[model samples]
Every structure is written in structure tokens, then in C-alpha cells.
Target: MIRPRHILRVFLLTTLLTTCLTGLSACGFVGFPGVYKIDIEQGNLVTQEMIEQLQPGMSRRQVRFIMGSPLVEDTFQPDRWDYPYVIRNGPDIIREAQVRIFFEGDSLVDVTGDYLPSWANPNAEPQGSTESEETEEAKES
Candidate 1:
């Protein structure tokens, strides 16, 4: 004894529910549009300026003041301090960098990893060459 109007309402509701379920499932497969993804940053952020300020023979206290506390300080390698940084946007990594500072006793000896001080750059123009060039120019004058 169902009326025609009741049957139509039920059919419409069922169709609407099915469509909603299908759309929600599709959203699971291909993330919902317009969703905001946050950029996540972690660990010490060492910049080029920080690296440039480093100099060999600096005291451990001076190095720490310039570079900040390290992210990893291994007990086995007490002389080495590791600074690692990462930036991620959702599931993708945007950037990753690391710097390892080594010390001999309480004196900073070496620095390595993604960034290096100007003194440590192998491809940098030699300081001696620039001085020699300046002297040659003066002699020519």
C-alpha cells in the first residue's frame, strides 16, 4: 500500500546516499581538493652565514655560540657534533641538510656535511693568488 510519492522519496534518498559514498571514496584515493598541507621543519637550521662564520682553531664554546647546539651528540664520538635539518610538505620532503663539526680536545678542528666554511671550500679562489696578483699590478704600475 505504499503511495507513489513515498516511493519517489525513497529512490531519491538512496541515489543521494550512493552518490555521497562514491564521492567520499574517491576523495580517499585522490586527496580532497583544496585541502591545505602544512610544511614541517625539524632540527637545527644551519644557514650559509653560520657556516661562513666558522673558523678553524675556534674554541668549542665559540663554535656552539655560532652554530647553536647540535641535534645529535654521539656518546661514542664526543668530539663530533651533528646538525641535521629537514623540511617536509605533507608526505614529500622539500629539503634536507646536515653539518658535522669535529673538535680536537676543546678546539674546533674540522667541519663537514652539506655546508662548509669558506676556509674549507676546495674550489674557492686561493687567497695567496689574489695577494700575488695585487703585488704584480703594483709592480707594473
Candidate 2:
């Protein structure tokens, strides 16, 4: 036989159990609202526009002026300059770009890395070299 007091107690227990289950389920999301995190940029942020300004014949001073000083300069490899850029949004990495420039003697010779220069293409000809090559070919013929 269920009395009114027993019914009241059962209802209270059911309500408490539902509340506990709801709270436990909500524990998965612990983040607060209205909070914002800023993205962090590290190392040299080399851009395509900056790379486009670089010419093969540009001096070290000129390259430094255009692309800024390299992040890593090895004493062993004085002619090799490495420019690396990394973006971080909290714990996750947003993007990374690495550009390596090689110099022969004092002149910038070539660039090879994960990034492609703006003017780097098989059909593209560097400034002054093509004209000199054409003149040389004519002379040879």
C-alpha cells in the first residue's frame, strides 16, 4: 500500500536523479562564454609580396631590407638564410611556411623550400639573364 508520504518521497528522488544526470552530462562543456584568444605569430612572417620584391642579383643588404633578417643564420653555412613563419591559435597550429635562400659568394643565387616564389616558374626567365643568353646564342651562331 502506497501512502501520500511515500508518493511525495518517490517524486523527490526522481527529481534529484534527473538533476544529477543532467549536470553530469553538461560537464563535457566546461568552456566559458564571451572569452576570446588572440593568435600568436612567431619567427619571420615572410609574405609572397615580400618575396616577389627579391631579385636574384640583390645584395645581402638589399635582401635584408626586402625580407628582413633571417630567423636562423648558421655560422657554418654563411651563404644560406632560412626564413620560417609559424602561426598558433592557442594549442593548435594555424599555418607554417619556410623559405630558404642560397647565396653564392655575395650574390643571391637560388631559393628552395616548402614555399614557391612569386616569379618561380619553368617558363619564367630571370631579369638580364635571358637577354645575355640570347646575345650569347647569336654570337655562337
Best by TM-score: 1
Per-residue lDDT of candidate 2, residues 22-126 (tens digit) = 897785466445667689999998877788787787788888998899999999999999999899976779999899988988888777666556465455567
Clashes (N, CA, C under 3 Å) per candidate: 0, 0
Instruction: TM-score each candidate.
Output: 0.70, 0.59
Question: Pairing residues by index, what is the TM-score of model 2?
Answer: 0.59
Lowest lDDT block of 10, candidate 1: 118-127
lDDT of 1 by residue, 9-82 (tens): 99999999999999999988899779999999999999999999999999989999999999999999999999
The runs of at least 3 residues in candidate 2 whose Cα sits more than 4 Å from the true structure, single-residue gaps closed, are 1-35, 123-141
Candidate 1 global TM-score: 0.70
RMSD of each: 5.9, 9.2
Poorly placed runs, candidate 1 (over 4 Å): 1-30, 128-141
